[model samples]
Target chain A: MARLVVLGGGVAGHTAATFAAKWLGKEHEVVVVTPNSKWNWIPSNIWVGVGQMKKEEVVFELAPVYKKAGVIYKQAKAVSLNPEGKDTSDKPFVTIEYTQEGKVGESEDVEYDYLINATGPKLNFDATPGLGDGSGQMGTNTVSVCTAEHAVHASHELEKCIQKMKDGERQKILVGTGHGTCTCQGAAFEYIFNVEHELKKAGVRDMADIKWISNESFLGDFGMGGLHMKVGGYVVSSKIFAESLYAERNVEWLIGAHTSKVEEGKIEYELLDGTTGEETFDFAMLLPPFSGVGLKAYAKDGSDITESIFAPNGFMKVDANYDAGAYENWKASDWPKTYQSPAYKNIFAAGIAFAPPHLMSKPMQSPNGTPINPTPPRTGMPSGIIGKAVAHTVCDLITQGEGAHLHEASMAEMGAACVASAGKGLFTGTAAAMTVYPVVPDYDKYPGTGRDTKYTFGEVGLAGHWIKHVLHHMFLYKAKLKPGWALIPE
Target chain B: MSIEEENFQKNDNFKLTMLPGAFAKRMRTCVVWQFIRFMVLNIKMLIVVSKSH
Candidate 1:
């Protein structure tokens, strides 16, 4: 029987493992290796950060669910890939280090017929000084809601700041990217607004000064060069929508900023204009830049093959047009349709683990020659979709034999729905529920914005708020492998 | 800040493109008006999605 080993167990890895197990079932072996013990519904981490939701509500033990799904779940972090096996054996195997209780730091080599690298990102906190404790862990200078634990910490910090505000203290709140090359401007957008919402609810709105700082060239470039949303009958640009939203909410912004360094209550930043400045805040939640989880790959003779298997950023190289050149020349075709590795046919990558051909936004470099651009966003809906598609291709190859057709899911051909929460409440809350057909801009197919305007829609109101809340529950339930879980769309 | 704005936006080869105002009027609100209008829009979207596949 063919053995399939999947690395990482985020949205991408979990989806791939479960689906492959179900499809292959008892005939082929499916193993999932992830460092985390719990599966987190990451989108709801915003609510958790604001104390709107409990950490338990967003996470569930992954082991039990994998057990029910008939997939071998290993609580371990992948260390290296021996895609060409060793001099002792011709069989390909992966080196994994256990992160679970008791077996922590222990290593093992497991053989695999096929490997799916969905190990996600390492949350490169070291990319900037003071973002991390100089050793890849988040520092105390700022709080983050990128992880469930980080969200819990952020929630407590936010509470303390609110208390200070209520006690006659005028607190400055800064929220956005921790570094220039960071992505997920959307999360920070949702977060800053949610903080505003929470402050208003706490009756300390007037006491707190909430400000946004981001790496986006424009206000609304949520990475994919800022999409145009069809609001009501008008095809309004997201820039105008975001600008008006910020103005209405009294939220001031500094765009095109690369936060260079962080210290207690202060941060030094470089703007796109080559100007340097500093901002101080009582509470800051900045997203650090992302990099590959640093998995090394070696050949049969133990020669380093990491350069051939991975990009400089350490993300696995898939079937993508890496030589797409400049922003003006970038095409949607540069995105991977079948996430197969060009070097090893037995390996594939999906989600954040895969190296995108290039940044979705126009790449920019500061006058000092430091590149400060928003990286491509691969989260939630897109990650799960890519994961499932990769799983489908892998299962077909394993079950139906070598000549079977591979399933393809291209970012250029798929649509994504994002419900960015501004607040979390039944009737009082609101979110911008946006739908973009084909996340990647297809300049050849649609020209201008490279999007089909008819299908790209967005609206903000209580309905969106309710929908986001519903999605939180639904996705968590699906992740838990509840009855009728497979019916839920990625 | 001013220089940063000039640096980022000023060098753009194409002028900033704005969307048509036909659908703009319906966008600006959050209370009862937005609630009713957006609910209808949501329903219409649900129908569109259901019909698409």
Candidate 2:
């Protein structure tokens, strides 16, 4: 048999196609494709953007969990990467399209003797200018919980700004990162403190006004360049634990910034000492900014090798050290331990679909130059431990053949464990949780805070909102392949 | 008064005057000290998931 496939079903393509279809069962042939037919659990889409969960409590229906994990789903949407096939099929394939329901756009191809990609990111909401809708989605004048129907349309625009602050009026709101190389500023910092804990649980927290905006040059450079942590026993420094939880919840910040534009309630910005401003609001959410969901590729006489498989901010290109230039010559061995694809060693790439080699924060700009930092986040628990270490090196190179041995996880040798939350009360909630360790920061093996301050610490109230509501029902019961779901780790 | 609101009013007056009683603020919803800090933060997140695999 020998097939594999797997493209994008989020959370690192559904943890590498449900652990490579339970380690290649039924003789071999996994499939997957993915154009979403519901799977979501995205960090509880920040408690469904504050209407406190319910979008069927964080999605599920991935065609009956890939028909009980035998795999072969394909709700489609890949579009290209013939690897080296067509000059009349030497067999590599990919193509895709569909998007389900009566084969929406219809187009196929399939083939593949191993190939993973894990096609994440592409919420590039038109990169900025009015934060998208010039055809790349989002844009209805700001709002996004980053799916789950944009967190049920950001809990109905934060319930019409909490019924216009229960009729008294005074709204404002805003949140963060619409551009300037955004990389999930911890999901807009857990959605602006869960919209200030649901406008102080609807008592209209003194008529609204919220704030916070990002691109982090400071205020907890969450994009990894700010770690130290520890907290209650002391240590500290995620910019003083995120400016002491946005000043003990009065919530207000701006940080380096960059936004640049977005109208219909105003925005614009610039900062990093270059000035230029504007801020108005009444409600916003922001986010967007992540590329590579483009795909393309080809070759075997098909010509276009799509810039030798991706990156120019389109991801893919794997096996790191992308000319590890500047930023004081970045190291921790320029990441990527074996996300493979150095010209297709049966291809790989997991999570935000690969490409990195730089920017664990510390890259700023703006003096009219504008670069504006913050990019490398590769989401939650290092995208499920680099999608189960690229599905254990493609199931040991398809059950030990071309000399196996390639499972390495490397985010400079793993270790991550966030929590975040900040509101969703079972007795007035809150959260933070945290942990760090190797998450890339080695500085020549732990010298001056390149992590491991005793597995980096952090902590906050109601037991981190009951461990973020028991990791939102234990990662949606380990992504619904339930019943012990391989003892739920990644 | 803008350098990001004077560095957010100097980190809100450096956390209301140099961490006076540095946060415990009522043992974070007390419920028996947050149920013994929710079992020591789930054994420190299973020892960082057993040292990340």
Candidate 3:
């Protein structure tokens, strides 16, 4: 029987493993190697950071779910990949170090006929000084909600700040981009609003000042560039909607900013116009830049193919046009339809593990020649979709023989729906529920904004807030592998 | 007040003035007549502009 091994158990890895197991059935073997023992619904980590939810509510143990699926689960991290196996064989084997129970740091080699590398991004907090402790933990100077543990820590810090405000002390709250080249501005956007909501709920909003800082050239450009949304009968861009929301909430903003350094209670920043300034805050939540998790690959002869297997930024290289230079020259066709690696035919990558062709926005550089642009973001929906597609291709190859037809699902041809919460309440609340068709811009099919106006729309009201709350529970239910789990999308 | 005196008061900055009950009734009728006259004039002007165009 052919063996298939999936690495990392994030959204991409979990989807690949479960789907591959079901499709291949008991005939083929499926093994999942990941470092974490629990699966987390990362989107709802925003509420946890604001003390609205607990860590346990956002994460659940993976053992029971894997047991139900009849799949082998290894609580271990992959160290290296031998794609050409040894000098003796053509089969590939992966080296992993267990991190479970009393077998922590134990190594093993798992042979596979096909491999899917859905290992998500590494949180590179060291890219900025005073941002992280250099050991994958947030530094004392600032707080982040990227993981469940980080959210819990941030919630405690936020509680302290709220108590200080209630004692009649004025507090300054700064939230946004930590570095110039950071992505995931949407998460920070949700967090800043959540913090505002919590402070108002604590009855000390007037005593605290809220401000936003980001590297986006314009507000509402959430990495995939600015999109048009229909509100009422009028068509308007997200820039206008986001600006109005910020104004209505009385939250001040600074765009096109590069946060250079973080000191105690203060952060030094440089604007796109070459002006430098400092902002002091009683509390802050800044997202660190993302990079590959640093997995190495070698040939059978021990020649290093790390460069060939990965992009310069550390994400795996897929079937994309790396030479698609400049923003004006980029096309929808440049995106990868099939996620097979160029070097190894059996190797595939999905989610944040795969390298995108280029940045969604026009590339900008600071006066000191440091490149600053929002990195392309592959959110939960797209990550799961790509994982299922990759699983289908792998299953076909194993069952239908080597030259079978592969599956195709390009990000440029898919649509995405995002609901961002401004506040959580039934009567006095607001949120922006936005749906954009063709997540990647297709200039030839639709001009100007490169999105279809008919299916693209956004509305900010209490109903939108309810939808966000419902999605949090719905996604967690799906991840738990509960009854009727097959009805849920990957 | 006489018609000449009433016209002087209406044209002044003081927007309101007291009058006898019978005189107030007559003033309301005159105001309605003046409004109808103004609307007819505007309609004639609009028709002239449209014809020219």
Best by lDDT: 1
TM-score of chain A of each: 0.99, 0.34, 0.98
**Model 2 lDDT tens row, A1-490:** 7988989888888988898889878899888888889888888887888888789888978998889898989898998888878887788888999988888998988989888888888898888888888899988888888888888888887898899789999998889898777987887888788888778877888797788888888877878898996877988878878777777666778878889789889989898888878999988998988888888888889887877878888888888998988889899888888889888789898888899888888898988899888888887778887888888788888899879899888887787887787778777877878888878798888878897887788887788788888888888899898898877887
- For all candidates in order, the CA lDDT equals 0.86, 0.83, 0.81
Candidate 3, position B43, lDDT? 42
lDDT of 2: 0.83
Candidates ranked by lDDT: 1, 2, 3
The root-mean-square deviation over C-alpha atoms between each candidate and the true structure, in angstroms, is 4.7, 21.2, 14.2
Candidate 1 residues lying further than 4 Å off, grouped into runs, are B1-53
lDDT per residue (tens digit) for residues A250-354 in model 1: 677888899999999999999998999999999999999999999999999989999999999999999999998877889999999889999998899988999
Task: Return the TM-score for candidate 1, rounded to 2 decimals.
Answer: 0.93
Docking quality of model 2: it rates as incorrect
The weakest ten consecutive residues by lDDT in model 1 chain A span: A243-252
Best by DockQ: 2
Q: All models, DockQ values? A: 0.10, 0.15, 0.01
DockQ metric, candidate 1? 0.10
Report the Cα lDDT for residue A20, model 2.
84
lDDT against true structure, model 1: 0.86
